[model samples]
Target: MADELDWQLCRSFLAVLDEGSLSGAARALGLTQPTIGRHIEALEQALATPLFVRSPQGLVPTEAALEIRPHAEAMRAAAASLRRAISGAEGGARGTVRLTASEVVGAEVLPPMLARLRERHPGISLELVLSNRTQDLLKRESDIAIRMIRPTQSALLSRKVGVTTLGLHAHRDYLARHGTPRSLDELDGHVLIGFDKESPSIQTLRAMGFQMGREAFALRTDSDLAQLALIRAGAGIGVCQVGVARREETLVHVLPEDFVYSLDLWVVMHENLQTSERMRLVYDHLATELKAYALTSRR
Candidate 1:
């Protein structure tokens, strides 16, 4: 085994990990499947370890693969930055900047900021990946991330973007039909829509003295949008961000004003791409936009 390895092989390995299959990686890289396979085979052979275990669902990465994923991602970001630097020198700062964020933020917050970026830098392309799951930034999964929770990894650079207030809310029609409860104890008699027990949001509610066990829920979903939709459909009461709830005429706050929770939002970037112009621009724009929601009066 040699310490020296081909950069292209590492790129292919990253593409496979991101796409979850050789065929997907081949399509993404615009290379033949056999070529992609050869790269992975060479990578495994060079490292003298199997990087992934084949599964019916897809290729599941082994421990060795997981260990090297962050490094491979760093290399990819470096390569992208190098390309951008050369291109910017020739034609000014211009290229695609990819961002990953939770669905709520993507839907409620990013549009205006992204519009501003397009207006200011039309040459820069933006890719927004919306999901509840946290993307692996070290793997170059996205150039930037807007997350609800602060990232624990030391390799990434993170900034507090803003904070959002959350509280129990119910549709006007539902509350009219079932009647609103005056206190937390009365919640047991009503149908509740809530996150799963493991969700941090639910845990926070629990800590705040809200009973959020499974027994209280008539409906539940992992997706923020799904939960909001159910709430809109008059399914039951559930917790929601004030920014989102404020926009809805039918949704009304259920609890007293003092009974609210706050969550700090963060804008994060891979250390490797911290100097990239497009990424920096997007990060700055998001930080500015989120400030509006941070103030208590805004909520």
Candidate 2:
């Protein structure tokens, strides 16, 4: 066993953990399956512990693997940040920048803005990770994160973009077919699209005086995009950001005064990236563009 841990080994280990199979990790890392297997073996030998065990489904991670995963992820993030920083110093904004955001924002909000960024800085390559769960900026999971809520990590440099204003909305056809619910109490009689499980958004809505549950929804899904799709298909009434809803003429506001869910949007990155021009450039660009987009939600 040695004190030094190889980064490549850690990468393979992480890939296997994420993909749940050597073949999947091999494809993800652009390496041969045997290469990935060797890396995992070397890593396990270095630590003198079995990281994973064979299972009927696939390679199931051992307790040791789960414990070491975060440390490996942190190292990966640091190495990526170092490469970006060095590239920024030697040249200009020419490197990969990984950005994470909620699914709806990633699908609906970021594409055009990222396109504009690519136009402005052709050397900058972008990687977007879309997930509703918060990505840990401190761990360097992403170079920058566009978050719906204010980030509380002390090591993160965050900027409040603006409020993403949400309101109850439905397709015109659905409203025409079912008629509009005149009040909150009347919602019981109407079809609704909402989360099938409790999430931060659902809890927030509950706190805001919406007394609906999973059973209340005619169609249920955790994905914001899926919910919006259902709304567009005239499936039922659901909540959507005004900024997003405005793009579809078919989506009409159901209760202008009744349901308003505003979440503070933020763009955050690790403080270590302060010196990286590419990171800074993307951060500023996101702040400016996202603020403008959020302002539209106010309308």
Candidate 3:
């Protein structure tokens, strides 16, 4: 069984685990669904155990799949490290760097900064993966990640650049139409915009005395970019990052002193890629630019 196992089979297995379905895994791997299915079938045959079970939602990994995941992940990480090492050896800060960030930051904050980076390092090509879900750095899903929360993975290098504050805000027109809430209690009377699903930010707000449920939001969406767009469109009052809100002149901060939360910004990369000049350059550039951006919100 050990002799039959190979990186290709392991790669497909991990992709399915990460994506939760054959189609998703195929898309992630840039392979056909039938090919991905064959890989999974071959992997299961070699191991002589079922890797997944059919469920209404999607493929659910069996205990056997979960048990072997760590070892497979370690192999994937090792391969990535080897690639990074070789690329670094042949580099002059000229290589590809994959970066991941939340949708809002990627769309709103990063464009100008990334443009500047491109101007400075013409040799460095970048791949940006914008997502609300944190990319797995250890899995090499992304070479560098700009995350709002601190990472707990020991195998990654990280830096706490700064904190970006968030506060309730609404378009000027919305406030004019429906008076601004002066206090927390008044929020219930007004149409609120927020995440449809519970998240770390929502949980933190709950812990900080903003005891509200998903039902509280009149317009609920998990996408921060979409939430900001809704607020800008005068849909409702919603949470907006200070740095982001500052750019929109029509966005009025609501109960600024009352409703405020800060998210710590982090730039992270795999520990194995520390020597990769391209990765380091991109990481440092983000750290510097993001810190400057955070300062703008405070003022």
Candidate 4:
């Protein structure tokens, strides 16, 4: 096996790659530009190859950088994991756990779980990045990830938290005003609210004979919270997960048992973090909390 490279240098390389320039990376790391330069130089010397090429576009990574990116990321995650393990061994649950998830998971799923985590581990801090785009766990962009779709990356570990049930929902007042359509064919005249872009749930709804197209959205927002708020305000009718829609009494199931879809939720972490006490605690707690809503009955 190749001799282990300098971890500090690898970390600097990752920082440079993430920030897109040495100066930016230096600012992020709170180090001088010269120090950052030395780190990169040492890393290249140790590996005996050029990892990046400097250009007008900033530091462009070479093929070697691309090849070793995953390993370098694993090293950084492992280091964070080690810090958590050491802290726990010292009898303190401390360190930052970075988590990434979609807007729905961030707004509807993780808040309660985070509350419980705060109560249980007072010293642990959480950094949550909520976006529709998938954050790379293997690249150390996040310590843990909550995703609707199961991840297939070989270097990451994943567990199915539970499945979420989705159904057509509308405000009680909206249904009273517009009247509920009994058949999918009757949906033509009824205004529908849905995700703007292609999503699994949207595709599922389309497959189920719902007429969802560019003209379907009477109101649309990227944030699930915003969408739910609009639905609660009786802006339009749309599909929502049972767990999210059930929380609001004003939002009632439209199709009820006639139309429903299910999607699996997965809690994923880099394999390097499996032994990390902080990451483990957060991951396990989220999984347990999510499992409670797995097979919820529509109200």
Candidate 5:
């Protein structure tokens, strides 16, 4: 153990925690397996505790390791943010910007905009993290985020992009085969695609008379992308972003009058990064592009 904790040891610790083995961590960090093993052993000695217990499945994290993970992850995010900040100051718009958004938005919405951005400023690079789970800007988990909800955190700078309208949609082929439901109640007779587990948004919908129980869905998944894919695949009638559905000519809007839900979309970044020129460029670009994307469903 040394006077000050080494960050490399912590980085290796976090990698092993995520990947579940020394070899896996080594591959992720581009280090050799023996180096990763030594880092882990040093980290454990520094902390004065055993971090992992081996099993037939692989190295399983002990309770101490699990408790240390969030702090280690926070350190990783801070290190990345610090690097980006320094690079931004030195190179103008030539630095990496990490952005987070939901799966559907990351896949379907942002690629074209990002391609254009790259064409305009080839020096600027992007790292996109796609998940339904919200990344904490305060912790610097992501430099910027596209959020469905309002940013209530004190140190966040946010721009309301627009609203994303959600509605029932079905492939033309599926509708031709099964017939379109005239009302919300008629949905019971058709194959429905929806969330396997109730989320806060679904709970809100249910409170507002939307029927989205797990049992009601014939094709069940929590991934918004999966639900949208099922609708595109003619799997069944499912809830999808109206803007996205319009992109596919085969997808037909179903029960527009009966069901209309809007999720408020925002582009948010940490207040600390508001002064960074490169950060501002990406932040405003996202707000502009997403606002346009949100308007497509108005048709």
Candidate 6:
């Protein structure tokens, strides 16, 4: 056993974990099956542990492999960030900037703005990761993030775009059939779409007096995009961004005065990224575009 370990072996291990077979890992990494096998064996030997065990389903990671997976993932993220930083240094704004945002915003709000960025700055390459789970900025999991809440991490640069205003909304057809609720109490009689799993954001809504539970919703899903789609499809009334609802003529704002909610939106990046021209260009564009979008929600 040696004090130093090879990062390449960890990469191969991750590929095998992701792809589920040595041949698949090989194809993914553009190497032969034997090379992947060797890397896994070498890594196991270096650590004096069996990383994976043979199973009917192919290869299954052993406990040891599972234990080390997060560290390896962190290494991968750091390596990618470093590569992007180096690439951006050579050319002005012609390098990759990986950005992360919530599923709804990424799917509904960001596409047009990103298209504009691509058209204006063809040299800049972008990678967008859409997830409800927050990507860690300190670990460099993403170069930039569009966050609903203000970032609390120190050593980070952030610009508050504006508050994203959410209100109860339904398709005009749904409202025509079910009849619009005149007040919050009247909501009990209408079909409602909402979250299946309660989250912090949901808790915030609950705190604001919209007490919601799984039983309360006629349709339930954790995905924000799915809820929005359901609202658009005229399934039932659901909470939606006022700005997004304004885009669709069919969607009717349910209750603006009595049932309005908002979350602070911010563009966040590592403080170190301020030195990179590419990072700044993308960050500024996101801040400006998102600010305008949030403003519309206010109206």
By lDDT, who's the top model here?
6
Lowest-sum lDDT 10-residue window in model 5: 203-212
**Highest-TM-score candidate:** 5
Off by over 4 Å in 4: 1-92, 199-211, 297-299
Would you list the C-alpha lDDT of every candidate in the order shown? 0.81, 0.89, 0.87, 0.80, 0.89, 0.91
* Candidate 3 C-alpha lDDT tens digits along 1-299: 68778899999999999999999999999999999999999999999999999899899999999999999988887776566556556777787777889888899999999999999999887878898887788778789999888899999899998888888889999989999888989998898988888877667667667766788888988988889899999999998888899988999989988877887889899898777778888989999999999897662
* Each model's Cα RMSD: 4.1, 2.2, 3.4, 5.1, 1.7, 1.9
Candidate 3 contains a number of clashing pairs equal to 0
- Candidates' TM-scores? 0.75, 0.90, 0.81, 0.69, 0.95, 0.93
In model 3, the worst 10-residue window by lDDT is 80-89
Off by over 4 Å in 1: 1-3, 14-21, 51-70, 77-93, 131-162, 197-211, 266-281, 295-299
lDDT of 6 by residue, 1-299 (tens): 44467889989999999999999999999999999999999999899999998989999999999999999999899899888887777868789999999988898999999999999889898999999888999999999999888788888899999999999999999999989999989999999999999877787777777677899999999999999999999999998989888999999998778888888999999998888888899999999999999988894
True-structure lDDT of candidate 6: 0.91
- Candidate 1 per-residue lDDT over residues 248-278, each given as its tens digit: 8888988756467777888899886666676
Global fold similarity of model 6 (TM-score)? 0.93
Deviation in angstroms for 39 in model 4?
Answer: 17
Better of 1 and 4 by lDDT: 1
Summed backbone clashes in each candidate are 0, 0, 0, 0, 0, 0
| Tens digits of lDDT, candidate 2, 1-299 | 44678999999999999999999999999999999999999999899999999998899999999999888888887888677556656656888889999889999999999999999999998889998888787767788999877777899999998999888999999999999988887888898899988887677667777687889898999989999999999999998989999999999998788777788899999998878788889999999999999889995
Pitting candidate 1 against candidate 6, the one with the higher lDDT is 6
Where is model 1 poorest over a 10-residue stretch in terms of lDDT?
84-93
How well is each residue in 139-231 modelled by candidate 5, as lDDT tens digits? Answer: 888999998888899899999989898899999999999999999889989999999888766775676677567998999999999898898
Which residue pairs clash within candidate 1?
none
Question: How big is the RMSD of model 1?
Answer: 4.1
Clash pairs (backbone) in predicted model 3: none
Candidate 2 regions exceeding 4 Å error are none
